[model samples]
Target: MTEQHDEPRSGTSSPAAASPALARLVGMPAPDFAEHVWSRAPLLTRGSDLPRDFADLFGPDAVDELVARRALRTPFARMAKDGTTLADRTFTLGGGVGAGIGDQLSEDRVLRELAGGATLVLQALHRSWAPVQDFAAALADDLGHPVQVNAYVTPPQNQGFSDHYDVHDVFVLQVAGEKRWRIRPPVLEAPLRDQPWERHRAAVEQAAQSEPFLEETLRPGDCLYLPRGWLHSATALGGTSIHLTIGVHAWTRRHLVDAVLGRIGARLSADVEARRSLPVDPGRSSGSEVAFGEDAEVVRSLVAKALHDLSVGEVVEALRPQVRAAQRAEPLGVLDQVERATHDEQGGTTWRVRRHLAAHWEDAGDSPVLVSRVGRLEVSADDRDAVAEVLDGIRDAGDLDPRLRRRLALAGLLVPADVSGE
Candidate 1:
């Protein structure tokens, strides 16, 4: 059984600092979820507090407002009728307020289609909606994985897409209304990104005819967790249904191996012997295979050498900064940043490392540096303590090296503590 822990101790460096983060979304703790249900089965938790947690995200009113007033264009918003995607032009038109602006959401057309049993989909709301952006950022940081959100508003008794399996794991939060879901086991277990449900259409359809992995109607405040490759379909019941799918694109061991391989490849390529040309004797037959002898030995030696040179810890350490850099950072204004760093040594302003930044100090290399999602900064030994202090948490501006603080702030790694929350 999944067990939830009390929220992490105060002043934890990251949201995920409390054990595994998957528990925050599900009531279960991370360890139990990973061992019992993760990548293994489906889970439905009813009467969850998610409805209140995400009360401001999306619903019938939000759909109406987005369709009528948001001036959204293609891709950002779309419609599907009876499992078929509808054309954008069918629900979009030129913005009336300006000429040659762009195609925008057509309220009348959207409402008409909805009335005709079409489901409206809002794509990538984290980029357009502030609250979603914040929630997604927090979740991503907590999970140590990239997260994206999409909202679906379906009419009563209507569905969005047909029975299909997602390539990424998803947590469906029933924000409003209710929907009946019919879910079956994966046709191909733990499918990769390229292995879509369409690849096994006949198999999926055949399986759908049999008993489902789960058959339940999720009401508001309920949540369902489906690992990637699980086939599922949902239809609204009684009233319009609205749900947010938080897709988690998990980073896997294969990725970590690849990262290590890349580092190994670079090191091997730098060796002169490893770069030597292969022996291609004119007398040798080129038919189907080449005779394996010294060439094979050389190849084996190269592989052995590469493996011998590889260091998992070093590769992983290098990877952390790259992953951290993938996150977006909020920068303090360049003008103000420069001013404070240059002239505000005595100012009362406090500064802190931007939240959710996977900041790491890399001192092993010849150039000691602080790397973060915002950017990387090369620093001298004298400035290492100051940078570390700043990264620890909120600190008085005067206590830090003003020049380094300004540089980090300018690089978008740090922000004034006051405005950082915004």
Candidate 2:
């Protein structure tokens, strides 16, 4: 039978509705957290320290529900035992009768693996699970970075994976049972996506031998923050342990550099000098090699010039699509959304950014355009502020012009936001 999950406790007010999720999550004020902890250091806070237990985010029931009843497909979930991932075939089978897709996760197989002490890993919980989806989306908005979620359900006294570090920062939220986490300083600090822990396995193994910076068993409601490249590992203490790992793919200087370099390359591509063929006659060179000295000098000069001419606006614009692709907000129900748009044509209901959209104003031939994820929206000069307000996530929709609201809604840029309590 298919099981549907509604809003699970969610602790305080809805993050998407009320306040910043980060403040409620980290057990510290948002500003303090930004200054002290963020990507700089590791922080471990007890549940009592937090506003409430993470019962709202996810729990044991969620684990069982995802593995068994969700008709979960492969890659969405996996299992590992003793630091090695179990083969997919061992726990997967094609759905029989009405269901035609192969590689669906076998509920019985999952149960067998669970009974035999394999750690069940539910990947990308932010996309599937309801409660964590809202929580993660709000966190992404709060952090101004992309966020992903995974759940690790380990058997008692069993460890899933060996000690290793991740390339992106992660918050280890202990949802249920007990897990003893050991934290260590990173061999490579604040590593980027290209730099996986596997690349530094030798150093990581050696570091694991040293005394850990922190070794604490987390009960429900406890939270641990580990910055990217910080080494860590955990084991279920006694009974089953379920924890949600929220990974923040924080923006870094490296990303900015890449964007700048990309723009530079793009600008150079239009230059005839950049596309000119290298010395066709290599035989004339001293060693018969393709003498790149003169060409290298010319290319260097062109790159330097391009860098000077490259605008920050161009770089930011180039990076928008990538950022949009990596992160997501709530999905819209088109029928209901359209109905709301039709009903609220007179502007009585509140509207929020559709999928938490980001946009910039540009002057097109026809007045001004609001360039957003959906497309360019040509707005009259007077109505731009109201549109901007909705994009800014303003709570007031009581006075918005009805026609403007309807246009924004149909454009896939704004949707009805239920911010009643807030």
Candidate 3:
């Protein structure tokens, strides 16, 4: 049975009496929590009652510590008679530097400054941060793929970012402040790759050739969902403002097709189609003298089959489980221990094992029987039930039978918990 979790206020629109039409627009579709807004413009809505104390989500102390340690970049700006004037700047992190008036500021500094000054943006410091992780989990449940958080802080009367767009679909949450947003209709829809900024600039220039979309202000608890290639700019109103921009990684049909072709290419290496020799003639052959080998025909047929599989979306479906598994997988550490073998003659073999679990493992067929956060053993018809049962019976450091435990150790499934143990 597929499990559904309620969307978190920080990452998505809250379900507190939203209009039916608006609810449908924001709800992540099924199978996976992916939205169907491919090649569309941004959608805005008011009355999205977001959580208060959102600033505590990033921990002001941590922000202060990071700033004190010089672990972040800081860019200062002051309002001038002409426009915003650039003040002092420093690069504390490893990102490259540029000479533009505002480009010298680190993203960390820009984000923190925006958070302190604006209440409309949510600040999700890092994916590993608990609140950020929790917000991502909720989004992942809706988007189906892992969702990453990018924080932004917009100060009043100050432009947060230059006119541009992002490569991924973004859900902007108005956490605590007010900000004005000017978004152009989406052009060059579904553009991907790292060159989104360049593409956005080109698109905005093109849009400006016509009538540009005017600006709109977002008060606290408002949200805006902008699809890829929708150029936009934001500025803080008069007070400090902070917001969270949850970006969903774009997956396209073309990407799915490429992955299937790759998988088929791997399988072809083992078939006669791959082993066949190429036809050659010492003398230049006339049209009548040339003959195509059966192998050549076989290869042509194999490639056609691979293309057909891609056309049918089989490859995309096959990859979905893997993607889901990666989205749910947790990080591993040295202190974790597991039992790998059972010796009825004695008891059970216990040993400590260390390995990074696959980031996604929601589906049973994705991997052989293994332990996971959901519980110890998850068996399916496709698995060898006997092996899985045996593995499941072994648990913890002190519970394994000695003889079986040694075998498990040899298999790398178990190791001595105590380094000094004889």
Better lDDT candidate (1, 2): 2
Better candidate number, 2 or 3, judged by lDDT: 2
Cand. 3 Cα-lDDT? 0.50
Best by TM-score: 2
> What local lDDT score does residue 110 receive in model 1, on the 0 to 100 scale?
84
| Worst-scoring 10-residue span by lDDT in model 3 | 75-84
Candidate 1 Cα outliers beyond 4 Å, as residue runs? 1-24, 48-53, 96-103, 281-287, 291-297, 330-348, 362-367, 394-398, 420-422
TM-scores for every candidate against the unseen true structure: 0.84, 0.87, 0.58
Off by over 4 Å in 3: 1-39, 48-62, 69-89, 93-124, 209-214, 275-300, 307-422
Estimate the Cα RMSD of every predicted model relative to the unseen true structure. 5.1, 6.8, 10.5
Model 3 agreement with the true structure over 280-360: per-residue lDDT tens digits? 754435544335455456778988776665444557556655464555433222333233233323444334542222222
Best by lDDT: 2
Q: Write the per-residue lDDT of candidate 2 for residues 289-381, one digit (tens) a residue.
A: 356667778999999999999888998887887776776545677887788889885546677766655668887665788876566779998
The CA lDDT at 6 in model 1 is: 39
Residues 143-232, candidate 1, lDDT per residue (tens digit)?
677888899989999987888899888988888888999988888988877788889999988988988767888887777888899899
As for lDDT, the candidate ahead, 1 or 3, is 1
The models' CA-based lDDT, in order, is 0.74, 0.80, 0.50
